[model samples]
Target: MAYKPLAHIPTHLISGILGVGKSSALLALIQQQPPEEVWAVLINEFAPAGMDALLLQDQVPQDAKVTFAEVAGGCACCLANLPFKVALNRLLRQTRPDRVLIEATGLSHTRELKHLLTGPEYAQVLDLQSVMTLVDARQLTQYAQHPLWIGQVQAADCLVANKTDVYQAEDYQNLQAWQMRAGLADKPCYLVSQGRVHLQWLMQPAVQEANKAPTPLFSPIISASSSSAYQAASITSTVRLTLSREQLAASWQTWYQQQQKTWGTHIRVKARLSNMQACYHLQAVGAEYQLDVLPLEKSSPLSSMQRIEVIAVAAKEDIQNALTLWAQELGILDEA
Candidate 1:
């Protein structure tokens, strides 16, 4: 059945694996929401620590009135998805908004998430607008081994190949494979960067139907299960640590040199920290990363100490060691 426009609370489940800019996309959407409306969001994090809630809260206005519910510590597709359901239902009842957005953990499988929304239970409460899958055009090389990542692209109603600015000429071909998987060679798949998409891009194309759920290349039995391959760990401090830009750059480069070697992978690491110069938004994903200084007013609400989150496919001990060492090198004497 074709969904009636705005007949119920329209929901857009933003799906993508790590570093695809799902959070950045949500930030863009949040910035553009009608100033008078209340937007509710449900965020999922593979690592037990959830940073999306804090990150999102920082980007919105002091009085913009965005409500959030977060499910962390595991895959949202596990345990019959109780965590996800609980968060979504609670957010809806609390906010009672006309639209909702769920930013699933980067490792989430789209089929299971889609089923939760389009299922009979939520069919009346949620008007499934579309599933937007954000792909980092540069990361297409490693995606083949991550079956669930591809599964997400296959289930998307619209595909967005983000980070195009950094993509090479040959990378566009990845979209063809993605389109073929969805059996919608003509579907609205676009190339964009910086998580910016036209407002129209968010609306369902009047006639585009949902894609067939993907068949994972993994063992079929567990293919349907959304299992998390990453573990998250965090280190906090009572007060901000002082570090120079050069020091920050050097430490990050050192981590890259060590972690990018064979058998080591860092999915993502995010930190909001203050230096003598200014506050910065720092992030690392795979072999690439970024650090941007936020305007003073924008970063003013943050606490003195940085709250850091590290997501990795490595073992839990390795993740803790990596993060702890990172904090120490950054000049923090105590890791809270």
Candidate 2:
């Protein structure tokens, strides 16, 4: 059956940096979906393996009317590209969703993505609602001056201080200090745990032109060339592992420490692993890492395969070679 011309479908852009729990936030929102409404989610990942969708698929309520599409391996900020437009158009036409949620990659430039959504082509199709940017108060001091981080914050209609359950008193203070210093004191800010934000925040009308901060002088991360000073690369693998959860986590932590000595401290790693006993999720950034045991019953067929994604501000070749060597060393990848 033919549907309406895709006009005014409530859409929200969920933006954040690496390891800030964008997928977690989307999962929480999906669980809150109205019983009668259909929701379509479009997720973009910086790495080719694209594990976020797999991680979320089994976690969403089995009864919710939710559909998903993903754009992986590259930033989806460029509307001129066919991959992004095709995925989005196909989703809207096929699902005829009552609401839409877009989760952009952590390295994405939201200003461009927002511009495209409001442009003539999609302006009528999507009722661009709120732009919610999730922030980890703990990273304020480390990434406050980073241009990409600044862009995400400036494009947000509201800021969510996620992972607050683990935050210390000083983390809260840092958030306030950064907000005032960044001239975002007037913007709505909410503190939540495990990426849970009230549904009301998603309904807030987006005022991008009025609230957006001035564009930064440097090139946006999506458009940066190989020669650009802000170099970064994402290396991913999909080989099943033979090690236990504890052994896998320990191996990664050791690898991270070794790489830091050569590549400095800027890095992010995420992996999903499963063995006969249980499934696990691992996330690491800077000098710290966390490994969580997940319910085996919730595992999908895709979850059975091991997946690893490493994103760092180092040479692509260097990162790839290092990961291959590390995996082989751990016997996760066979020597060829």
Candidate 3:
């Protein structure tokens, strides 16, 4: 037997804004993976606790040939950064996967990451494919002037309007109008619900050239010491505080209502919580929120611990204070 080099691994970047279903889309793609082919996923989350990985793990089949790694606490946009390079290199060497999926943090600018993937270092090892940017049709106007959002869209080879099941006719029209206004009307677009993207889309030729000069709307790559436009804080408790389903929702609503003005339009919160009767996953983007019950058997190990991650545009102190208040009201802090 002779040692053989692996073929170029197909790589895809799944980019999106806060709470736009990037994780769900990535999970859907993972579920569609062929059993024989090994796949690797790199997830970047603004929160240090990496709640997305936990939630995603709960849903992924235990027997699937998928490997996941997370770069938490900040965006992994810069290739020179040690964490990004180390995690990616480790995964590539360890798994030797057929494909790789990198999910950028919602607040990340993808231009640099895209450049890294297509750069000389990876040119021979990775086949950089379509850069899929997912958009929530309902928030087109809300993020119209946002630099991070603009950068992600500009770096995309294709666009996906996820969560289409909740969209009204006007939302679709706004998406079309925005695409034209952004000079992206000619780009490949898909409308899907619950991030149900077909596998073929990932194989499309990447039309966005990495060497092209970025538009003014595309913000500069974030630096280590530079102040971010957003603030993120994580709240964790070892004991699960008992509350009725209504009480938990009401508590969040009350806290959000108090901080809504300060948090502005960019607020997002994800949590694994429990009520008196069951455990649930709660996700809130802007003012809307949804809760889905989690199976006890799958969530038991984590059920005793409640974890919440919040991202907002407010000051870090303000974000922390608000979350603390919310936690106190919900009895999460008392146990902590």
Who wins the TM-score comparison? Answer: 3
Per-prediction TM-score, please? Answer: 0.85, 0.87, 0.88
TM-score, cand. 1:
0.85
Clash numbers, per candidate: 0, 0, 0
What is the lDDT, from 0 to 100, of the residue 81 in candidate 1?
91
Question: Model 3 over residues 1-336: C-alpha lDDT tens digits?
Answer: 233355678999999988899988998999899988889899988877788877777677777788889888888863345688888899888888889999999978788788887778788888888999999988776665566777788989899999989899999898888788779987889999988997789897566464554344322343222336588998888666678887787877777667777666568889887755677788888777887776666664556667889998777888888788787777877431
lDDT of the candidates, in the order given: 0.73, 0.78, 0.80
lDDT per residue (tens digit) for residues 1-336 in model 2 = 556557799999999988797888998888788898999999987777677887787577555688889988768863354788889999998999889999998877887788878778888899998899999998876664466677888888899999899899999998898788778898899999989987788897787574355444333333323213323344334556678877877788888888888876677777777767777877777776788787777776565666667887787788788877876755655334
Q: Stretches of candidate 3 above 4 Å error?
A: 1-6, 78-80, 208-227, 275-277, 300-303, 333-336
Better of 1 and 2 by lDDT: 2
TM-score of model number 3: 0.88
Clashing residue pairs in candidate 1 are: none
For model 3, the run of ten residues with the poorest summed lDDT: 218-227
Candidate 1 residue-wise lDDT, 154-196, digit = tens: 6777778888888777777765664565365755777888898
The parts of candidate 2 lying over 4 Å away from their true place are: 1-5, 78-80, 210-239, 330-336
